[model samples]
Each structure stands twice: as structure tokens, then as C-alpha cells.
Target chain A: MRAVGEGAGGPKSLPLILARELAANLATPMFLIDAGGTLVYYNDAAEGLIGRSFGEQGEISAGQFGEMLQLTEPDGTPVRRRDTPAGVAFFQRCPSHRVLQATGYDGVRRTVEVTAYPLFGTTDEMHGVVTVFWETGG
Target chain B: MDVGVWGCRGSLAAPGPETIRYGGNTSCLDVVLSSGHHLILDAGTGMRPLGVMLDNAGVDEVHVLLTHLHLDHLQGLGFFRPLFRPGVAVHVWGPASPVQSLSDRIAIYLSPPLFPVRLADIPSDVTFHDEPLEAVAIGSATVRAAKVTHQGPTVGYRIEEGGASLVYLPDHEPSLGVTLANHPADWTSGYELACDADVLLHDAQYGDDEYPRHVGWGHSCVEHVVDFAAKANVGNVVLFHHDPYHDDDDLEHLLVQARARWTSAPERVRLACEGMTITLDANGVAFGAQAARA
Candidate 1:
């Protein structure tokens, strides 16, 4: 049977399409979210950190992404998603970075460094945001 | 608004005795708003005739919304009468390229050994819009262009005028990345444009039996197109971009298959044929005359 969710159908603008392509090429973990805050794509490297492939998650809302991966400070202090790099980049339309602790879909907790930036066109048109992160936990 | 198909033949211009019934031109559509605004959807060979009609009507300005720079889609630009007439304002809009600007990409074909005339050699005052993510107003009509899945940089347009919406996705392949069945409306490519549209001219270039061989070709088969229309819940589905290889009988067969699939289609499902016009008003969609033979 054909696998679902790798590159599921969605209204992807050119920038998002190119971002997804770029993400797939990078060995680092990456995730692509749409203007609507829907998690549209994630790279194969991201699958390890995510504990599941993008084909498995399909498309999830931003809130859903938060619920799927609850994050906290290194000391286990609860943190709001809006404080994360992805959240700041999405809401502020700028670049952001952070080191946080999180538990992925597989219930494994890990500390990771995350960097995110809004995807923009040459004309400064906002397509969405691309989030990349490094995993410290296996 | 009145939507007319000047050329529905897809891929290549198939002018022959077999294609006479459906007309043998590539993908050009003529849209006339009630306010006398003229919009040509593509610059296929059918555009030549549409340009002549505009010239006969003495229209000094026109907008051509292109889906992409594919040869069949751009085949009629050189012959379009308005582009050759001085004092004519020709506005062309299409998808943006990664390496070059839209005008430069178009110029690649308009100039050189491929064509005798250069894009600059045209007499009309031509303007090219590289990428159009923002909606633009042409008269009272609002035109929105969205990127769609195809072989290259391509987009589908949604034209909303006077409470009626007509979406033109002449060369789309929404089934490329994802399966069409039970997919969320928002997830399907070109869904937003076709959602509740009064008339949708969607790509239905292949039959189901032939789709497997042409998966990445960026054209939709009858079954897939019907599935997309159902998901979009459009009012009427006008099967567009007929394969140049398919003759009238083949198209008729495809239509029959489409009807079978869309049994509960709200208004109806019809094939886009050359010279076929569809009108939209407060009363709803009304079929206009066509050059089709009995």
C-alpha cells in the first residue's frame, strides 16, 4: 500500500514547496508549517526526533503539534509553546533560537537546540515558517 | 460573467479531422464580464481567435492569465492580434520562475530561433507580472492566483465577480503528493479556489486506465478530477484540458465516466469544448451556445 503523509496534498505555495524540498535534502531535523499554522511537512531526519514520520502525522494544527510534543525548560519547568523558536518565528515573522526539553510522540524525553525562521519570498511575502532542531536524545 | 472555451485541447494542438468536433486548439478561455471587461485565461492557439473577436469588438485593453509557460499554453501568444496592434494594452500574468523573472522566461519563447518575433518586437504595450500571490482587480472582477502542483511553475486562478466565482485550473495534478480520497478540502491543491465555485474548469486530461503511466506528468485523470470536484463541492464541473490524443468519441466516453462518478453533481458535469460558453448570474449557472456538432 502507498504510504500517506510524506508529501500529503495541501495548498503549498512556491516558497513552501521549495522549503519542503530543501528540508528533505538536509540531514538536520526540519519541520514545515503553513501560514495557517498547520504542520505541513517534516524531513526524514526529523522523523527520528519526532518519533514518527510526517506520513504518520499527516497534517496537524499548531496546537496539536504542541500537544504531540510537550516542551519544558532543561530543569523540567513547563514552558508555553509560544516561547519556542518555532512559535516566536511564526508569530513575530523573524528568526528565533532556543534550547529546550521535550517529549516526542514515542514518549521519549530529550533536550534539543531548535532554530526557526519565517519563510519569505524575494518580495517579502510570507509563505510560512521552517523549524530545524538538533536532538540530544537518541 | 460569461466563460467561453476558445481552446480545450491539451498538451499539444491537435488540429485534424478527428478533433474537428471538439475543436483543435490548445488551452485558451475567453471570459467576458457584464461590465465589458475581457479576460483571456491562456494564450493557446484558441487565443488567436479570441484576440480576433476582441479586435472585432474594438477592445483596446485585455488581461491574459496564464497557467504556466508550457509550450501548448503559450503557443498562440505570437498570433494573438491584440499583441500585434499598437496602442493595445496587453497585461499578462503567470507563475514566477526560480532562476529568471516571469517576463524573462516568457521571452525565452517569444524571442530567438524558436519564434521569428521577439517579445519586445510586439507593437502592443505589454506588461508581465512575475508572481501574483496577491489578488488583483481587473475591472469589477477579482482575480486570485494560487500555485498548484504541475511539472513546472504553474498556478490556478479564481475569478470572482458579482457574487459568482469561476475557477480555472487548466493544468493541475492535485493527486501528485497525496491521495485524493477523503482528503480534507483545505489539504487538496486548488481546493480553496474551487470550493463552492459556480463553475470549475479543472484538468481532466487522462482516463483512469491511462493515469498510471503518466503519474508525474501533472495532469489529472477523469476519476481523480471527479474526486477532487466532489471534495470541493463545486456547483458545476467543466472537464477541461482534454488530451490532444483523445478524439471526440474518447472525450464523450470520459464525460460519461465523469457523470457516472458524479451522479449527484449539483448543477451538472460537462466537458470543456472549443467555443463552448458558460454564463453565471444571480439565477445560477446557465449553459450557453457551443460550436459542438450534433
Candidate 2:
């Protein structure tokens, strides 16, 4: 690897690299995934919302992230991996947007809106997805 | 693995008395693995001559990895000897376009009005791959293709084997409108394909003085290329894709300027010329023992 990341090995995919870069620059919270369903990255802005630094949780599965954040629907139903914006974008290879409730590691629950889009290279090869989210309300 | 530079000129083939020393064929490179498998980098005018030599050498199977479909890079496809030969397996790999299929795009040149022979008319068993399933293994080399900063859909290649890696971005401009330093390694275009490779053959088509006029033309000036190489921290940097307008003397001047500005390691930088073959192994990069010196 040319340059090391906090929790994951350096991304070799072009789209991943560009995604990671764009994620780092923005003030909004962002999450990244690989094609095989690995949660490869989260920006520093995500620390407060996700309740952990990327350094502490490098690469994890979507289910693991769900468990860590304890996500649920606004009506108090637990969210499945396929129902989240990231999951829909991954499985459907399309954009996803939704409002959901999440219980942070610090025991604070917040309503959040997530927008996700699949990352594809110039040849239409799927690299992963980039998910951007923000706290909508308490 | 050995990297042979068949042609290093960019944009167009400028073969004349003034450009004689550097030779005037556009972007073509030849990589021969220890197992005798050949990987051709581009199908520029230089590939025509390289094809002749490969045919004479009796090499049957070859993989041609094209960066893009620019005319300078695709001009030599019809003239390639192996594409015309019988019983030869010619696998052509290129960047996939969202709109057109690889076979259809390449046929624009290989077919009727442009050339007498259609792509299907070629005798060799030709296989086209617009998409490489991530990293594909060829002989002893693992090749990964990723899109880079270029005019049309272009991709840089990273070939790794035996702990050595060679990155080819013969037509790249990582510094278009923004300062590359403001971004992380992952943010910069072409950085992922080039990071930590033993050899990085990148585009150095213009000097700093000539760059402002050609912004977004998709070729790097000397300053940007050298800066990018230093930032990537590769073992060696071979300035490739020489501008056709720059004569041999001008290229030397650029080399001098590059070395002068390369604060990290001046000795690690050099220019790409026709017939310069680089060998990479566990021992690291060995450059230009067979180079055609200017």
C-alpha cells in the first residue's frame, strides 16, 4: 500500500480512492463500502454521529455496523441491512435516500437522513458505495 | 519482469530529423514476464514495429492493454502483425465506455472505410475485454486497471509480481485545476494506480512554461509529473509520453529541470525513450541497461 489508512488497508480501486478523498474533504458524515459488503471507511465528521472514530472501527460488516449503532425505523422497529440507504444502493446499484432513527454508542438516539449512491468505474464496474448522512432531528 | 519502451512520444508521431534521437512513435510499451509471456501497453505507431519484432521472434500469444481510444494510441492496431496472423491468441483489453461496447468502438478504426479489414476479418483468435474483473492474472503478473485523469475514458495499469510493481499512466494529468497537495493520497487521480510501484511511467508532455496554455488538455507538464512521482514515492520515475513538439534537446532540458526540482530524490528520475527497457525483481528497479541512449 502507498499510504496507510486508519482502520483499513489503502484502497486500490480508483473510485474508492476518489470517494475516500471526497469524504475526507466534506464536513458531512460519510460512510464507504466495498463491492463485497465491507464498511471500509467513515470520515472524521462521522465520529459524533456514529459514536466512534474510524481508527477504532476499521472495516466491519453492515450488520456489525447496524449492531454498533443500533439503528431502527422511526416507529421503533429495528432496521435490516437491506433496508438502509447504503444497503439499497449496494443491492440495487441505485441512489437511496431515507430518514431513520439511530441509537448511538453513547446512548443518544437521533433521527437521520441518509443519501447513498453506488460507485462505478469508467467501465461500469462496481467498486462500492458512498453514503452521506446528517442528523435531521432528535 | 522487463519493461521495454517501444515508443514514448505523445499526441502524435513526430518522426523527423529534429526528433530523431527520441524517435517519433506514440505511446507503446512492452513488458515481458519471466515466463516469456508478453504484455503490450498501447497500440500506438510504435506497436507496428514492436509487432514486427514479436512476429519474427515467433511469440504467439499476447495481451494488449490499451489506456484509451485516442488516435495516437489506437492508430497502430490495424498494422499490428499478430492481429493478422493465424493461430495466435490476441487478447485486447481496454477501458469500457458506458455507451459503446469495446468491440464496437475498436471496430470504428479496424473496419471498412478506415481500413480494408473488419475486426471480424482478422484471422487471429481475438478476444476483447472492456472490463477486467478487477485484477486479472497473466502468467506471473497480476494486472489491475483503474481510470485515471485523461481526455477520454483512460485507465492506468498496475502490474505486480514477485513483490515488484510497475505502474503505467502514459497519458495522465493529476493536477488539472486544483493543488494536489490539498487532497489526500486517495483523492488524487491516478495516485491509487501508481502508489508505491517500483516503476512509474507517467506523462510528462510539457514543461511548466507551456502548461498554462494547455490546461485540461489531459497531459502533465514536467513540474506536475515530477511532483506527482515524488508524492507517490515510487522507487523510480520514468517521464513518459514525450510531447511531439519538443525536440530531443528540449527533452534533455526538461530532464535537467526535473532533476533540479526533484528535492526528494533527483537520481531516481529519468526520461522514457525508445528501446529503454527496465527490469524489476526482488532486487528493485534496474533501469536502462539496454537503453538506446540519446
All candidates: CA RMSD (Å): 5.8, 4.9
Cα lDDT tens digits for candidate 1, B1-294: 998889998989999988887888999988889888888999998988887888877899899999999998998999898889899999998887657888888888988899999988899999988545667888889899887878877889999888999999999888875568765565567877678898889999999999999988999999888899888888889998989889999999999999998878533899887878899888888887765421
What's the distance in Å from true for residue A29, model 2? 7.3
lDDT of 2 at A49: 90
Model 2 chain A weakest 10-residue run by lDDT? A1-10
Cα interface RMSD of each candidate = 4.8, 3.1
lDDT string for model 1 (A50-136, tens) is 899888788888768876788888888877878888899877888999888888888989999999998765445677788999976
Which residue pairs in candidate 1 have backbone atoms (N, alpha carbon, C) closer than 3 angstroms, thus clashing?
A5-A55
Q: How large a fraction of the reference contact set does each model reproduce?
A: 0.23, 0.47
